[model samples]
Target: MSATTSARSARLGLRATPEQETVLRRAAEVAHKSLTDFVLDAACRAAEQTLLDQRLFMVSGSQYQALLEMMDRPESENPGLTDLFSRRPAWAKE
Candidate 1:
């Protein structure tokens, strides 16, 4: 974790059955991590995987071709996009 991420201030509470707690504690010991660290790391990994699963997709060959064709198409004029791009981004220094 980065310095910013290391300063965690939120709290999460959970309950597990005795069997589940024992298994988790054993796994934490085997990994040489504190119980909280082990659970947080495992949970973060799981959360990342879950989010990636939602955003990523498999495309058929024809569908992929369609996507490529769309990308290769020329852009149309748009007043909104032109106006939007005219200004500098907020994060950019003058």
Candidate 2:
């Protein structure tokens, strides 16, 4: 087997109702693919689409510039953080 084919040593089992199996079998036949290949291909495409829809994004040049400008703005001071600077380092005191 080719490396790509050999890499798929894991097995997955899906138990479908008879009607669902019939539908999937017919689709596999129409696509000229084995049931497993058809299912695997479709499942992978759907998974990619799902992840892209939720996680991946694109921004226009103007939007990208706005994000950059926002990040470039000067950092604001926090009262609690500034208070920490007055203390000496513990290792130095030791």
| lDDT against the true structure, each candidate | 0.89, 0.85
Report the lDDT tens digits of candidate 1 across residue range 1-94.
Answer: 2123478788899999999999999999999988888888899889988999999998999999999999999988999999999989999998
Residue 81 CA displacement from its true place in model 2, Å: 8.6
- Alpha carbon lDDT at 83, candidate 2: 82
- List residue ranges in candidate 1 displaced over 4 A: 1-6, 59-94
Point out the worst 10-residue segment of candidate 1 by lDDT: 1-10
Give the clash count for each candidate.
0, 0
| Model 1 lDDT on a 0 to 1 scale | 0.89
Q: All candidates: CA RMSD in angstroms? A: 7.8, 6.6
Error of 2 at 30 (Å): 2.0
